[model samples]
Target chain A: MSPKTLYDKIWDAHVVHEDTDGTCLLYIDRHLVHEVTSPQAFEGLRMAGRKVRAPEKTIAVPDHNVPTTAGRENPDNMTEDSRIQVAALDKNAKEFGIHYYPVTDVRQGIVHIVGPEQGWTLPGMTVVCGDSHTATHGAFGALAHGIGTSEVEHVLATQTLIQKKSKNMKVEITGKLLPGVTAKDIVLRIIAETGTAGGTGYVIEYCGEAIRDLSMEGRMTICNMAIEGGARAGLIAPDETTFEYVKGRPHAPKGAQWEAALNWWKTLYSDDDAHFDKVLTIEGESIEPTVTWGTSPEDALPISALVPAPEDFKGGKVDAVRRSLDYMGLTPGQKLSDIEVDTVFIGSCTNGRIEDLRAAAAVLKGKKVKDGMRAMVVPGSGLVRAQAEEEGLADIFKEAGFEWRLAGCSMCLAMNPDQLAENERCASTSNRNFEGRQGYKGRTHLVSPAMAAAAAITGKLTDVREMM
Target chain B: MDKFEKLTGIAAPLPLVNIDTDMIIPKQFLKTIKRSGLGVNLFDEMRYDRQGNEIEDFVLNKPQYRETEILVAGDNFGCGSSREHAPWALKDFGIKAVISTSFADIFFNNCFKNGILPIVLPQEAVDTLMKDAEKGSNARMVVDLEEQTVTTSDGESFSFEVDPFKKHCLLNGLDDIGLSLEKVSSIDSYEEKASQARPWV
Candidate 1:
């Protein structure tokens, strides 16, 4: 057999057929659907008069556009528009024989977080969602990517997608990471180096010492924002770290089946002489706790650096930088560390896991959020919320004057009522700082969860590494 | 999907990079499954003031652009979030074509599926269109899909590329579901074999 990358191995395994025109019917192991992107897909199915080809392989959950008010009494209280969308999902799933977790269901949460926590994501499988952060599932060694609603419709009807094969790119980080630097910082650094569209037609595989050393949660944080760097998907080959995380979860194989699955997973990695279309290497030791000062994820810099001037950017990118500065109300040639934030959010699919909460708690223990600053921590899922409570991570956040709320995307997207006020600047631990993403006129500066916690205490874009 | 053969309409200029889906239709309006009735909410936040009053400064809210059926936007148009609502909203707002230097992969595909022609031109071509769009209702650019060209109202012309398969799909209003159903027997056989091999899944 020819030496192949892990992506090629998995992708080839699932390709049903490839046409002469380069169209493929790629089998999907898991199809995760959400409220925002699935309604029209279901409508497409209804219009086509077809049924889901494999209802057993599909899992439906409503996360986006769901209210996160903690202990909401009735579905009636949800905004009329949101209520319509959520109810439509419930109606669609029941009609199509797909399992749905409504807000009332305990398993209901963000699809990306819930998929891994429940073990629906396994090694060497292809997963997809209507949501872009579906790349988060790739951490488990699955080939996953976001699809447009039309593709969502195609997947629902056929249990397979007409996909184009993406090029393979290898990004190796060779040195050890500093203490306060995290997967969030490393991923932001990768994007800053690659520019937003550098990965346009590629599927990136993160490898070498730094990526291999990360825990499963850390790897997920990196994969979740692979789309932010314009990659179709990002992957990390499943090692023992990946196996250990998936071993005992609800949907993981058990008994003798587990042994067989592990044996297959062991062979799922790329061979020693695997080929790649492109390769990039980064020295990890020098990376600082990074943060974004501009709109795009690629607009990131080390926390130790000053805000960049338009001249610092070259060619077509300078206009983007100047526009970002204008929208963010930031001045070039200014220090990023001195920028004050009125809000700090410490959760998202990017860094709202148990380990992320622990890291934040480690920094915020016995400290307090700055006066007149509003800070909050919304866990990604109910399970993460429960684990945080069991470990008293919630109490630490509350004690530090941060509002500890229920699990949801929360201020990460402002889908619910949790949003930034007009012109409010937020130090956020989520992906994407696009203008008005948090809310109308809201400004976001992306950082790690620990950096967000530190900023909450200092009321500025403080470097978590300096405090450590 | 609506048939998209050719169009010549006034183009509105929205020169901002990363014009994400959230800003296109917004999460607030994503509730309804119906693609219609979204034109009122297109660029809801930018077109309307906080009090829900129209912001006269917004191009779409201006009287001259009220009937715009073409859009000339900035680079990386329709980036962020894989909501088809972005294209749906634009289509509902009577936009038949969107011209930009580049587009995000998902949004670019979504546009073709939803009967909106997303044209990718160079920065200079987009600049010329932006200037022409600034001329308001008088500037009507012709987008001839058959000829693979976009001609300015003053007869300046630029050619663009489109994937041949997608171009075929758009020309005939072909949907992927109808196309995939062609392999139903092959799909069923594969599923049976797959189930036998991986029953635990």
Candidate 2:
């Protein structure tokens, strides 16, 4: 028999029982809910006369539809739609007796960011949220991933989820990362190599020299995009770096319990000679500043690579290629570097960490955004915002003509009032560049935070290497 | 109450991959957290043309697929950000089940809460279902919630299994909150005793 991977071990430990249909009733350790997906579940509960089973284990936060700029003072600043949504979330959380971090609470931001900042994210835990970016918590060595609304309700009621075990995939990146290369670049390169659906049905364990050297923030940026590559979750085994980050946090265990927890987390790594369903390796040196040229994250290339021609997709996918180009208003064979952007957005759970802001600020030092270019920088969380301000990064952004705003999922998926006008192009640090992702008919070019800052300064898709 | 043991209806075909939440319900409509009243605007951008008129070429616009209760979608049916509204919109559009080779993790789970069954069949199973659904409006398919089986008008039957716990919850219309409330009496009793004993509250 082959040695089991860490995913298999963790999954086995959580399995309650296998149902007749082959799906296992796995116990969930933590449940995170948001306003956008919780209302219907709450309504379902009401109609059925149900009460939240373990309200203490469930946490709710309003992020997706809240206006990033509006604090508690001007609730009216939130659009009528978002305001209603936020209010509904608040009502449901209160009625159900679930702990809610409302927007009025200074700790509120994106659910993914809130989970870790509140010390709710811990190793060896099974965390589920209604948002796909729930995989962001996997950075803590937890078995975290997103689920559906029904599952959300199920977990809320039973503190458990029905799931099938996923296969294991190991993605190893070796070699020292060159300067100016960030985890965003690493994930983009991974997606570019593996296509969008490469890791389907697999839990990806990122390993090797490059991953071991990454800070918790960098590891988070890598794991945040696991869904983009079709992975259920991406994880890094706990190490000294992980311990240092979690020690003395608000919710982390203290003293002897903390030592015991650290011992268990240290053993969460894949066993020697562990077997994986699939394995892929990439060299860190081969990676360069990356960006998405087409609609999908997989439709990406290094800054040096030219935009693909329609004919390049010689197979039946020519239609897809043509459709993406037409939607993006890009001509075939045009260099991706030559594309001009009307706006620059730096936010979203994917790249809204303090480190992301610092990277952008470093690129924007003494450089101003071009006139007429709309640039907005929203931090991922209040904690991150405070740290950025303490370091004077917010001033650098404000001086550079970028609107430094409060924390929320701003300009990412255009859920709130912050949206792009029709047909406007934006260079964004957020994930996903699907048609009208920022707004209806809006074109988004996905890039790293530093790259977004460079584009804001130049008013085009200029190379960050050149600016550096 | 009439038990909804099975659902049978015309199938709508959406062949696109990665039909994200934004396309299902544009962010503009996300203002209201309420799950109801979103079905009409479901697929608004695709259902209408640039002039805001209903597009004749769109699948939902066709009279045949207007009452479609089942959706036969392509691979990667739900990709991109996790928004529960995607499933809510699909349920509101009367799609009770979606048959696809694959689905995004979040969207697949969301289907169950809205009374939508997301079936993840193999590629071969999906191709067969797609062909049956595309045979026009009269191609009625039956999805037996009780048996976890899908039978087409052509006399073909495929059995898919769901967790008995989930099936039980769906059948009785019980949700997480409902299950917890079943023990409310015990909880109240325990709380009464604890408060009397401690008197801290």
Candidate 3:
């Protein structure tokens, strides 16, 4: 057999049929569905009178439009449109016989977070969802990527996807990360290094000492924003760290099955001799606790940097930089740390895991959120919320004058009521700083959990290292 | 889906790079299960202001481009989020073809599935068409999927590459779901072998 990259190995395993034109019918092992993107897909299935080919392989949750407030279980609490969408998912899930975690279910949360927590996203599997953040599952070495709603419907009806193999790109980071720096910073720095379109048409395999040192939760954070860098998916090869995390999970293979799975997973790494279409290397130490200063993730800079002037950019990019600056309402040459924030949000699939809560709590202990500054902490999932409560991390946040809210994708895209008002600036832990992503005319500065917590205390985009 | 053989219409010019999905149709508009009715809200935030009035400066709101069935955009058009609604809104707004220098992978794929032809032309060709599109409603561009070429009012033409399978589906207005059902036997046999080889999945 020829030496294979991790992506190639996974791709080869899932091929149900191959066309002469290189298009392949790939079997899908896991499909995570959420409210915002699945309604039209389910409607398509109904129009075609098709049944879900593998209901057991699908999981549905209502996260995007569900409020992160008390009494959120009541559909009436949501806007009519949100209520209708959520209700539609409930009807479709029950009618289709797929497993569902309602808003009231203790297991309900963000689809990406819920998938790994239940071990549904496993190594060597092809996992997909209608949400772009489906790349989050790549942390488990799964051939995971986001699909369009049309593809979502196709998968439901056939349990197969038409796919063309993506070129392989390898991103390696070396050296140890500095204190107060996290996986979010590493990924942000990578996006800054490679422009927003750098990873287009390629699947990036994140590797090297820095990547291996991260926990699975950290790995998830890195892969979650692979879309921000324009990659369909970013993955890490499964190793001992991955095995330990998957062990004993509800859906993970057990005993002999586990041993057999491990045997194949151990072979999931790219061969040293395998060819790569592109290679990028970064020094981990060079990355600071980073924050995005513009409407795009590619506009990231270290906390110590100044807002860039449009003239600093060359042609084609100068206009984009000017437009981003205009939308963000930042002045040229202003220190990033000097910018004030009206809101501080600490949650999303990007930074809503247990470790994220802990990191924020560590910074908030015995400290109060700046007076008159609003801050909130919405854990990624109900289980994650419960774990934080038991660990007393929730108490730390509440004591720091932060709103301890229910779990969902709260304030991430602001589909719910947790949104920034017009022209309000926020220091957020969610992915995507695109205009109106959090709210209409709302300006979002993406940061890590600890950085967000630090910002909450200082009422500005402050460096966490200063507090530490 | 509509069969897209050829389209001859005014091409609206939007030269901004990285026009993400959120800008196509904001999240608030995504709650609707239906694909239609989104044409009014296409580029909702840009086309309208906070008070719900149309922004006259936006190209789409201009009289000349109001009936545009094609769009000429800058590089990396549709660069963020895999919301299929982006293409749905474009299709609903009567945009049958979009010519760009480059496109995001997921968005490019979504466009084809929705009966919209996304033509990726070289920078020089795009520049020529972009200037031609600036001629407003009078400049009727021709996009022929059969010939895989885009021609401007001045008769300048640029040929593009389209995947054979994708082109077939677009030309025939055939959905992949119906096509895959025809191969159920192959799928069933592959699953049988796959289960034995790796039951853990």
Question: What do the candidate models score in CA lDDT, each in turn?
Answer: 0.87, 0.80, 0.93
Q: What digit string (tens of lDDT, one per residue) describes model 3 on residues B30-139? A: 88888788889999999998899999999999999999999999888898888898998998899999888888889998998899988999888999999999999988
Label model 1 with its docking quality class.
Answer: medium
TM-score-superior candidate, 1 or 3:
3
DockQ of each candidate's interface versus the true one? 0.58, 0.31, 0.82
lDDT by residue (tens digit), candidate 1, A223-254 = 99988888889999998999999999998989
Ranking by lDDT: 3, 1, 2
TM-score of each: 0.96, 0.90, 0.99
Where model 3 places Cα greater than 4 Å from the true spot, the runs are none
lDDT minimum window of 10 residues, candidate 2 chain A: A313-322
What lDDT is reached at residue A146 by model 1? 93
- Stretches off by above 4 angstroms in model 1 are none
With a 3 Å backbone cut-off (N, CA, C), the pairs that clash in candidate 3 are none
lDDT of 3 by residue, A274-330 (tens): 989999999989989999999989999999999999999875678988999999999
Could you report the Cα RMSD, in angstroms, for every candidate shown?
2.0, 4.4, 0.9
Better of 1 and 2 by DockQ: 1
- The docking quality of candidate 3, as DockQ, is 0.82
